[model samples]
Target: MVKEYYDPEVKYMLWDDFQIRHIDDLKLKVKGYSDDECKEFDTTEDILQFYPNFKDFIEQFFAEEELVNSSTRLNYLSNYADTKTYSVVATEQLTGRLHVNENLFKPSPKVMEVLHNATYEDVYLYDLTREDELAVEISKREEISTDHILIHSGSSDVIKTVMSLVLNKGDTVLISAPSWNYYKSIVELKMAKAEYYDVVPGKNSYEFDVSGLMSKARAVSPRIIIITTPHNPTGAVISASDLETIIKENPSSLVIVDEAYLGFSEQKFDVRHLLAAYSNVVFSRTFSKLYGLAGIRVGYGLCAPMAKQVFRLDVNPFRVNNISRKMAVAALRDEKYYKGLLKDITESRNFFINEMNSISGVKAFDSAANFVFIHFSENTDVQALKDYLAQNGYLVRLWTEGSRLAMRVTLDRKETMEKVVALMKEFLEK
Candidate 1:
């Protein structure tokens, strides 16, 4: 008795239904779907009743925007942060960047020189020779064999390579809740399951739920378990003792320790030794954080020799571009410069935490990474505070994962940190 149009949720409308269709932004138009024949197509069952090719029709009618939005909804970075360039205190990124250090740390001079002086042969080159050199440099720095390292686009690529090599449909990978969302995204993309353990806040700071993690690993018998040290958002570093326990307990599982921020930690642990000792352990590192080379997009993984061979096979040929490979080698060679950068960040981290903790309703966690994790009291309107910060040209990560309401303030130069402290003090006073 009532006419029904196909809903965006249930019954996907076909493009052929519309004689002329147009999509502006997220809206869609279809001509045939507007007619009487498609009026009753409210559900999948309804579509099947009239259209014999229900599945094919739905596939043909699927919206790309809707599919991408739905797939990446939970993994959205801007949900908890902003990237407004107008902000005076741009603390949203945990990258090793400074307002004054623009392009200073990047090996742009060498890159430009090479490009400018290059012959036509260099421009059209499809060689992996530079990448091999990069692998050797990284191997020397990481104390791993060159065979155990594969140069890739970034750390995420390394994760994908490993998962591709080992994971199959119905396999599981263990991750921590509120961990890097990419792990779950990639695992799900592979048609595998992701089992999460919790990272609970500790008296000192955020610590992994080792007992819970081990239990979950035992239950899932996951093919992989990802552990991030100097962890993202929380800035927590897993102790060597805890790491040992997890590695020993999960003998059957491959443990990937993502040490992306390890260089910025107060006490750095040499995880390279683990590669020699354990076949199942792999350490992932990136130049984006400590080396101030986020734009160059270079990262690598250290695994046992056999697993590295599998990674080399799984990764695409010449995955790291020639320029990126050269820059990575340069960054590794300029250790003194990056180490100075680390020292500055460590100091800023300490200062920011101290100043933040001085506020009446705020508690800043002691961070081993380049950012400070701050929690506001129940009485404080954190969202309103974040708005105030944004309005006043400050951008920081406002995290509301779980029941916790906190802000992740990236360590900046002293002048910027002072401005951030003054801004928070003003906001609190108001």
Candidate 2:
């Protein structure tokens, strides 16, 4: 006797590498699903693709040689301990008590004075009821059509809210293949189906199966379309020409562009340029990858004015939390830190690609994001390669199939890069 709506839990985007697979985000329970930690860290204690704990791999590589000294180990542990204070989860919990002498909650003075003088009613305990002040601030900052940046507990909350606002049930969604592999999971839960397209892999490497996508878009009654840039699993960006074509053709479908890794790109292409051109485009961005805000869960979606009505109707209140928003605000202001990381990523990405190109059995995939993908020679010993290299003190990503050697390496410092390359060269030689 009750009407059932699309569940957003099934709509959350997924990352296949270095996440907890079997367990829920609260990290409590496990379902009977089969996949290594490659899909998620809640997954098995397999290898870490991102911040890989490669110390064991290091020790084994030089087992016949001298071990890292106790003093050195202590120094490394000391650095790790020092890092505890800066963790996003820890900071979020400790934020309210944090010293505001530094002006943490201080919005632009012009912005703050207005809030200070305004009549405050309870909307998430932040001037939410102020007739026009908070409304204008959020509208300008978030591009919300009416008012309020939706408060969300996590990516799942955002996804579910979007679904309720837009589709009724069984509206077709189009996605590309060889993605993070969780689009199917989200769709299955909402009774939505995705027609997947393919990306042609090779040099002049910025190509997607646009015709395949267009055909599917027309054939199915597609209500939504999603694509990623600095693409996951593959780091290629959608070319400008192709993007224009896609936008022009998909008039009826509300296109969702997940620019999760846009921060990792060398050139910045604001989806705003496209969103301004087409009212049908929706831009989703996350603080997960480059911001190191993944665990604390801060993500935002930019939609055209018409779409915000549905989004506002669908989202929950104070889901973001005072601390997470503060941290997000902190990260945005701390462009200095991001700039330093960006430099490291650019250098590391180039090194990784050059190294991959040098390897005889490997074909490196073009990537503009933080990680790199590789296709290995047909006859290469994939598992043995991973195991042998593990003993040699480096752990690269191992794909499920045979004859493919691929790893998505994160950027650290210059010294770390030298060590990674040296170890990789040693393993490949053996």
Candidate 3:
């Protein structure tokens, strides 16, 4: 039997401190776990063998870790509530990710049938420039020119590719406060600065600060400005006229309008038309949202002809997979299926907002997208409320901008949402 270097009973206790990012203390604790009686290995799997309980820790904690420069590091958000169980609702998901009960619609049966008939060999395509087939289809739907479209895996991939192709070192990028955090991290990864404009909460909904955005554009002269329609977390949108004005105001800068949730918005703007009118306008659309093809992972964008050339240079021949390509085409073609899902989501969103607002100290904003933005009164203990929700088997995306404690809660199916609202009411009272 191997002699243990550390007390076996207390070994697991170290994980608690490690989780809160006490790296120095964690390093000290790890040395004790190393046994001089056994051979040492540097590989993660081998290290896990010596520390058996570290399996899940390694898998979850370090998967998306980013080492920023020399001094800073990035850590992923924790999913404190267990996601596997039905009672532990995953309201944290911001995408149009459907629950099992929400599968009222699906991709066309013909797509699956065709896929079955299709051979694996036929899936590979030599065309690195996916410009003609799917791009043309997207152009037709978005009312943009074929030369302006590029098909990619998803919005995240598209954003990375665009950043790589467009930004230079020390250049600035502008995004809204409380927008997608990934955008800021990616901008930093490219060695560009990220500046944020504020999104002020209004009487019934959140409003974008178009003037503040313009002011920042003039002050920083950002290389790119990312404006998400039916914006993430807040569900606020910049109107078509406002978006065009911003583009016109910042003629030298590239303005990217992310329309990932546009299909679910109450007011859908045709920002694709700006592609033809402006040299620096880029509009991204994803099948992840209204199409309910989040798993398929297909997203495309409309940009200037010059931007397309840069994208071609940056991207490989087979950027998007065969299954994603075909499935996206099928999903896009099936308008009826998406329309049904949209109706269901819209109804649920409204119901959720109304129900949440009815609770004392809770202010649920009307949402244009699938998730609703909510805030608690000053008297309410926001962190305590979140803990209560998690303990009661409901998980939500909680965000803070200054003094505000907001929750971006996903609107599940009507039945599920009704139960969640009831819990919220009870929790608020408590």
Q: RMSD for each model, in Å, please?
A: 12.8, 17.2, 12.1
**Model 3, residue 163: C-alpha shift (Å):** 1.5
Query: CA shift at 76, candidate 1, in angstroms?
Result: 26
Residue 136 of model 2 has an lDDT of 41
lDDT for each of the candidates? 0.70, 0.57, 0.71
* Per-residue lDDT of model 1, residues 281-379, tens digit only: 888877777766777788988888888877888777655677667777777787677667766776777788888888998888877777777888776
Please provide, for model 3 over 377-414, each residue's C-alpha lDDT reduced to its tens digit, 9 standing for 90 to 100: 87666655554555445555667666456677776778
Q: Tell me how candidate 1 scores on lDDT.
A: 0.70
Candidate 2 structure quality by residue, lDDT tens digits, 211-269:
88888778885887777776766777887667767777888887777677777777455
**Which residue pairs show backbone clashes in model 1?**
17-31, 17-32, 18-30, 18-31, 18-32
Deviating ranges (above 4 Å) for candidate 1: 1-122, 128-131
TM-score of 2: 0.64
Cα miss at 111, model 2 (Å)?
21
lDDT of 3 at 173: 96
Best by lDDT: 3
Q: Which candidate should be chosen as best, given TM-score against the real structure?
A: 3
| Model 2 score (lDDT) | 0.57
Stretches of candidate 2 above 4 Å error?
Answer: 1-157, 164-168, 204-206, 388-406
TM-scores, in order shown? 0.73, 0.64, 0.75
